[model samples]
Target: MSLLEAVAMLAYYDPDSECTVMREVPFSDSAHILLRFLHSRNFQTFMDGVPQITDFRYTNEAMLGIVFDDNFAPLGMIQNSMGFLEGGTVVRKSFPQSDLLMSIPLLSDLVGSMLGKGPYFIANDAGPSPFELGKGPLYRWANFDEVGTQDDPLFQDAGGTTTYTTTENEVSDIRDVARVIFKGPLNLTEWYFSTRLVADIVAALFPFGRDYGINFLHGDKLESMPKIEFIAEQGVLSGGTFMFLPIPGERELIKGYNHMDVLTACASLPSPGSARLRRAPHWNQLATTIAIPPLLVPAPAETQTSGVADIMETIEDTLMPSLVLIISYDDGNRVSNSQTGFFCTPQGHILTALGGIRNSPMVNVKTIDRGVFKVKRVMGEERAFNLVKLTADVPASQMKPVSYNRSIPVYGTQVYAVTIPGPDEKTVTALQVTGTREIPGIGMVILTTPSIPAYYNNCPVADARGQVLGLAVSESSGGAAVDFIIPSAVILGLFVGATPVSFEDWEAREMLQGLDNTYAEAMRLLWLGRFTAAAPLFERAAKARPQDADPLYYAAACYENTKQAARAQTLYEQALKADPESVKVLFSLGLLHARAGRAKKATALFAEVVDREPRHAQGHAELVKLYAGVRNRDLMQKHLALLRGLDPDLAEDTLYEIESAGRTRR
Candidate 1:
C-alpha cells in the first residue's frame, strides 16, 4: 500500500471575487443572466482556478459544466462553454452539441444566426431540424447525433442528465424581460453541494444559506469549519471555496499506505496509525501507562539541565527566603507551636493557614532572620484557600513581603516547600504538585503533591521564581503522605471588594455604553456581509474604545473589502500594535500576505498563529495548503498531524476533496 504524502487541491473559488457586470434581474430573467455571466473569465477562474482556461488539462470547454438550483435541488446546466470578458461583458458563446437541443428549435440560439455554423459546437450555431426528411437536411442533435440524413450513422449520448440550456447571444431586449428582483452585495452564511451532475459537474447552485445569525466575533476554530459561506451581490454569484484534506491512503486512490509516514512517527501512539491501521487513543484521549516507563519532561536541547533534583534545587534557592514562620497564641499566651506565614500585602499584611490561626485572638510572626513581630488584627479569612489574612504591627520597612504570581502553574512546574527547621536555618526541597483534587463538602482546592513532614503545613509553597503561593495544609490523617497547598490568588481574593461608583461617573459610563452599542451593531453588519456599511461603524467603535484591537482589526478588514487598500493597511498595523498576541489579527494579516503571493510573510504569520495557539485548526489548515503549494511534503504532513490532533472530522473531509477532484495527481 502506498499513501500520498502531499497536498491535493481541486478547485479553490474565491467567494469575494466579482463576476457579474450586470445585476438586478427578475426571477424570469435571472437564470438567463446567470448563465450569461457563467461564460466570464472570473467564473472560469472559480470553476478552474485560472481565468481564460482556453483548454482544460483534463477536458475542453464542452466538458467544463455547471448546474444551478434555487437554494434546494438541481435546476439546470450550461455545459462545455467559454466566455469572452470584453467591453464590460462576457460574450464568448457556449454551444452545447447535446441531444436535448434538437427537440426545441427556438429555445436554442437564434436559428438565423446558425446560418453557416459548424457541427462540433453545442449547437449554438444550429438547433432542431428546420427541414424535414425529403425536403432538406435532417439536422437534429438530440438522443441521436449528427446533422445528416438517413445515411448518417447515429451516436448515443446520455439524455437523462441535461436540463436547461442557453446561448450567450447578446439579447438587447433582456432588460425589458427582467427587473432587479434582489439587489445585493449581501452575505449569506449557508452550506450546500450540488446533488446531481451532468458530467461530474455541480448541478446545483446556492442550495442553502444560513440567514446572518452570526456566531463568531471571536476567532473560534471549531465553529468556522464545515459550513458553507455565500457572499453574493446582485448579479455576480459567489460562494466560498471548499477544499477536502485527504490523509495518506484513506481513499481508493492508486496509492495508499501502512502507517502515515509523518516525520513524527510517535503521533501514531495517540491517533490511529494512518498507514499502520493500528488502534490507539485519539490525541485528545488521555493515556494511562502505569507499569510502563515514565516519560521524562522535555527541556530545551541547548540547555544542559539534566535531573529533576538539580532543576528543582535551582527553583528552591529562589523561593525559600520569602516564606516566614508563624506561632499562634490564645489570649496573649503561647497556644500553637511554630506555624507558617508569608507577606500578603505591601502594608504589612501576613497570610497564614486558617488551621494555624485556630481562631486565636493573637499570633506571633517571625522571619527566617529570627526577627519577631506582633499581629495587629485578623483582617479576613477563606475556607477554599485555607488561609487567614492578618495585619502585622510592624511597618512595611521591616518586612520582605512576597507577591502573588497570577499565572497558574501548569501541571509539572517544580514547586518547593519553604520551611525553617530552626532559627536562622531556612530550607527548601523539591516537591511536585502532581495534580489536584476537590476537597468534597469543604469546597477547597486541594493540590496533590509529594509528601513532606507535618511541619511543612502552614508553610508557603513557592515556584522556581520564589513567588509565594498560599498556605500548604499538612495532612491531619496519617497514611500515605500527600501535600495540598492553596494558591495565593485564591487566598488574596479573600480581601477583595467591589467599589461603589458615584453618579458623577455617568458621562464615562455613557461613553462606554455607546462604544459597546456601536461595537455590537458594527459586528452585526460585518457578519451580514455589509462591509461598506460596517466599516464606518467599526471605526466609530474603535475611536470609542481605543485600547481594543477588535474594532480596529474589523474596520481594517471592512476597508479592505471596500477596496480602500491604504486605509486598511494603516488600521491593520495599528491593530497589530494594539494587541500583538491576537491570532485572529495575525491570521488576517497572513491572509493578506497569502493573497499577495508573499509566501514567506504568509508562512511566517501562519506559523506564529499556530505557535501561539496549538489548536488553531484554521492556522494549521492554512499551513497545510502553503506547504502543499511549496511542495514540502514533510511540512505538510507535520501540519496534517496537528490538524488531525485538533479535529479529525475536518481531516476526513479534506481527504475526500483530495480524492474527489479531477486533475488530481498523487
Candidate 2:
C-alpha cells in the first residue's frame, strides 16, 4: 500500500477499505464556477443555522503572520517579533479612512470604554457609509449605550471550564484581539501623566499602541497648550495644528493632528497584535477647524462644486479671517471713508495706502472679529508710492499675515481688485491688464489694468492665478480705463529687501510634492486676494509644475505684483523660453524691459509679436509706445496705423502710453 494510504489506515484504522474508487475528470472553467456556486450555497446554509450574534466586520486592517521560528528565519534579532523582506518607514503616509461601511450594529459598544480618554471611538462608529446609508455620520459620537443585564450569551462566553466574574473579562478575552484593552482616562489638564497606564499598555501590547483618549482646551497638555494659545491669541503660525503623541523610541505610536488626533492611532499591526479596532475618523468633515490646511481637501460627498465655490472657500480660509481692521480716515469735516486693512507682518504691522491714512497719527480701526484699537501709530511709509506701514495695539502674530512673492505680474494678466464699494460689501472684481508702462529707477513697468477705480484707489490688485500684482494708485495717467499699479517689485523693495530668484535655480532646489495641489490652490487664491498667503503656495506650485509655463507665469506675476521687478523679469524670460509663441508672455517680457529702461530688448520682443500677428492690438500699441519714447516717429506711426485699425478706441486712449514713453535718450 502507498505510504499515504498506510498512514490513513493507521490513524483511522482503515477508511472504508471496500469503498469503490471514484473516477475524477479534468477541471474546466465551468466546473470551477459550478464548484464555487455550490461552496457558497453550502456556506450560506451553514451560516443560516449558526444564529447571527454579530457582523464579523473590521474597521482596522492587520497583517497575516504566524509565531516566529528561528529554523525558518536564521538571520534575525532576538527582539524582532516579525520580519518581512523589507524594513522601511513611511512619513505621514496613511491618511484617515473614508466611507466606513454601514453596520448592522453589534458588539463594538464596549470599544469606547476600552480605549483611553478621547471620545472619537464613541463617535467613529459613525453609522454607515454614505453610499449605503445615503448619509454618513456627521458626528460619530452616539447619544446613548445599552444598560441592564440584557447582553448576548455569545459575548458572555468564557473558556477553560471557568465562568469569569462580572462577565466583562469573559467578553473582553474574545474582544481584546479586535479592540483596545482599557487603561483608564488620560487627562491632558495637568503636568503629570499616569505612567502606570503607559507601562500597563506596553507590557500588554509591546512595541505598539492602539489609541488613547486625549483632552483639548480645559485639559490641554501644559507643553502643547502654550503653543496653541500663542497661535489662537497671537496668530503667528498658520494652517492646521499638529501635536505628536508622547511616544518615545525610533517608532512613534502614531502622529496626532489637532484635537481629533486623540482618537485612534490607525497604525498597522501584525497578526495576534493587541489592538482596539475602531472605525477611522471622518477627517474630511473636520479639516478647516485646524490651524494648517491638509493636503487633500475632501471633495463633496454628493455633488461636485463648480470652480467658483472652491475659490470662494479658499479665499475665506486664507484671507477673509485676517482682514479685520475697519480702517477709516477723514478728509476734514465729518466726511469719513473706510477701507479694510490686512495684517502685513507676524508682529502686528499693518500696510495700507499712505494716502488712505492721510499721515494721520491717530485713526479708528476695528478688528474683523474683535473690538477696535485706537491711537494706532504710523510706523513708516514709502511716501513716493503712497504706501504706509502702521503699528496698532494688535500684533501681527495675532492674525494671519499676507505673504509676498518675489516675481512680478506680466502685462494684460487678469487680476482681482479687492476693494470696498458699498457700506456692507467687501468686493472682489475680476479685471484684466490693459497695458504696461516702463519707467527708470522703479525697476518694473507700471502695470495698468481696467480694474482700477476712484473708490478702489490704494486697494490691492491680484493676478488671476493668485498673487497680489500691485497696489492700485489714483493715477491712470490720462487713459480713462487705466488704473496704474505700483508694481510688486517696487513694493517689496520698498519694505522688504528684494532678491530675484532664477527659474532654473528655484526649480532645481525647491522640494516638490507627489501631486499638483499646491499649484491648483495658489492659482485659486489669486481671486481671493491673499498675495502674501499665496506666495509660498505659488512657490510650491511652481516647483510642482516645472514643465508647465502657467505656474511659473503666476509665480512671476506674484513678484511683479509685489514690486520685485527684476525677479519677475527673469521668471518671465524662463516662461517665454518654455513657450516661445506665447504672444501675451512675449508682450509682458517686452514690457518688463521697457520698465527697466532697456528699450532695445523691449523693442525686439514687441517687434517680434507685431511682425508675427499684425492684428494683435496690444503688440502694435506697445511698439508705437516704445517708438514714440525714442523719437522714432516713423516706426511709431507705422504701428500706430495697425493699433488704430485693430482697435480704434484703444488707439484713441493712448495718453498713458505718451505719459510713460520712458526717459529721454542721451
Candidate 3:
C-alpha cells in the first residue's frame, strides 16, 4: 500500500473523525487514475459498488497519486483548518459524525490542511470500539439516537445499549479523488486553489477590488477549451454567468480570465455559490463599456467683407462720444464774422487779425460746443504790425501744445499759398518763398489777387513747412503777374529788432524789397481811397491779427462800400458786440441799417449815440442824414441844429456842401 493509502485508512477507521487527502498530478494524466488512487487509499473506496482496500503498510507512497484530468494541470494548494493539501484530493468523511464522503477537489486542499494542522482533529474517547469503528454499528447507533430515547429504556440507561432496526441508506462509498492535472510541469506559483481565497486576499489588500466581486472558477469550462464547440451568447460572458480561478501573483496577465472559455467551463459546473463565483462575467464588460472617446470639435467660420464693415461701424459708434475738434478754419461765414481771420498756433495759441480788436480790445472766441469767450489781447498796436498772440486760460492738465519751429532759410523758393478772398470775389493769394533774392534779400515772395483791387496790405505768408517767407504788401497791373511779393530780408532790416539771415550763397540774394514795399504802399493808398477791390487785401491783413477790431471794422466798411449791405450789417453787428463802446462799430452799425432801408431804426440809433456823446459831430451828421431819408423834416433840422451847436463852422459847411453836391450831381 502507498503512504497515501495508509493515511486514508487510518482516517477511515475512526467514524467520529474527518479526513482529507493531498496529491500532485502531472500535465498528461486521466481522471480515472485519481479515482483508482483514492480507491486504494481508503477502506470505503468502491469500484462498481464493491468495497476495495490494500494493506495500509504495503501501499506505495512513491506513486504521488493520479492526476485529476487528462491534462494533469497543476492545482493550487488550499490551506484550511484541516491543514494544507493539494487540490483534487477527496474528503473521506465529514468531521465527528457521518460515514458518507464526497469528492471536492477545490475543498480538498483546505480540508486536508485543516486536518493536518492540530486544530481540526481530536482523539475520540470512545476509541476504536466496534460500535463506532465501522459503518453498520455506527449507523445502528445513530438510528437509535434518532428514535425516542424515553420509549427505549435501554438507550436511557447509562450502561445499557438498545438494538434498533434501521432503514438501508446509500453511503458515499465512492473514493473520488479531487486532484488537478496539467499538460505542463506544475509550477507552484502559477496555481490558484480557489477563486474565493484569491479574491478574499485581493479585497483585503486592496479595498477598491470589492466594487466588482471576485469569481473563482472561470475559463475552466469545456467551451473555453480550444477543442470545444459552443456559441457563447454576447451577454453570457458579461452577466453573472461564469466563475474563474485567479492566477496568483499574475493578476494583470489574467485580468479577463473570467472571459476565457476554459475558466468559464470550470465554474459552470454545479457547486455551492459564492460572491467570487458570481462576479466573473460582469467585471470585464463594465470596464469596456466605460471607456471614453477622443475629444474633437469643429473650427469657427471665417469673417467676410460685410462683417468687417460691421466691425468698423461698431468702432465708430464706440469712439463717437470721444471725438474732439480738429484744427480747421471755415472759409464760409459759418462762425462769427469777428472769428473770420483767427488762426491756431502750434503752441495752441489763437492768433486773430489785429484790426479785429482795435476798437473793443476784445475778441470773441468760439469753442467746439459753440460757446463763446471774450479774449483781451490786441496785436499790431502803434505803427509796426506784429503777430497777434491770444493766450487761452487752458489748464496744464487740459492743454496739448504743439512745438513751433523758428528757423529762416535763404534762397527764397516759392512753395505754397494760403489765401482769403476779397470783395471782387477773387482769391487774395500769398506766396511762400525761401533763400536770397537780389532785391528782397531772403525769405520773400510775390503776392497777387485778381479779385482784390490794385492795392496791398502788408501781410506775411507762411509756407506749407510753416515758415514765414514774405509780406504781401502790393500789386501792379504792369508787373509779371499783376502782383508782387516783398522779400523778408529787406523787411527784416527795416523792422526794429529782427533775426540775422544765413543763405546758401550770397550770389543768390534777391533785392525786390523796395519795389514790393512801393507797390504795398500803393495798395494801401487805394484801400484808404475806399476801393471796394481792396477788401481782399484788407482781409489778408485782418487774418494776420484777427483779434483787432480795426481789420474787421474796415473789412465790414469795404463790404458795405461794395454794396454787400446784408453781409455788412451782419459783420458790423458782430463788431459792435465785440466792442460795444467803439465809435467806429457804432457808426458802422448805423450806416449798415441806413443802407438796408431801415431809416427809422438807423435814425433812432444815431440819435441815441448823439445823446450819449453830445459833442459827437459824426453822430449828429448821421442822425441828420437818417432823419432826412425818413422825411422827418423836423427831426432832421433838430439834428442839424445839434451838430451846429457842437461844431458851428463844420455844421454850416456841411449844409452848404450837401446842397452844392446835390445840385452838381443833378
Residue 45 shift from truth in candidate 3, angstroms: 99
Q: Which candidate is the best by TM-score?
A: 1
lDDT of 2 at 448: 44
Candidate 3 per-residue C-alpha lDDT over 36-78 given as tens digits, one digit per residue, 9 for 90 to 100? 3333323333233222111111111111221111111122122
Total clashes, candidate 3? Answer: 90
Candidate 1 residues 1-666, lDDT tens each? 000000000111211222121122223344444443332333333344222221111111111111111110112121111111111111222233223553455533332122111122221211123232112211211110111123322222234242221111111111110101011111111111223222122211111110111111123343443332211110111111111332222212111111111110112211111222122222222234322121222222233234544545655566545557788665558665666677767766766765555545456777756778766666664433345666656655557667666545645455667776666443665555555553311224435434545777667777666776555665432133345766665566454432333222422443354424566556545544567887898888878777767788888888878778778878888899988987778988887777778888899999999999888887888788778778899998999998999877565445434433311242
- Candidate 2 residue lDDT tens string, 109-183: 122112111111011121254234312222110000110122431111124342112211111111111111121
Which scores higher on TM-score, 1 or 3? 1
User: TM-score, each model?
Assistant: 0.32, 0.28, 0.23
* Number of backbone-clashing residue pairs for each candidate, in the order shown: 22, 42, 90
TM-score of 3: 0.23
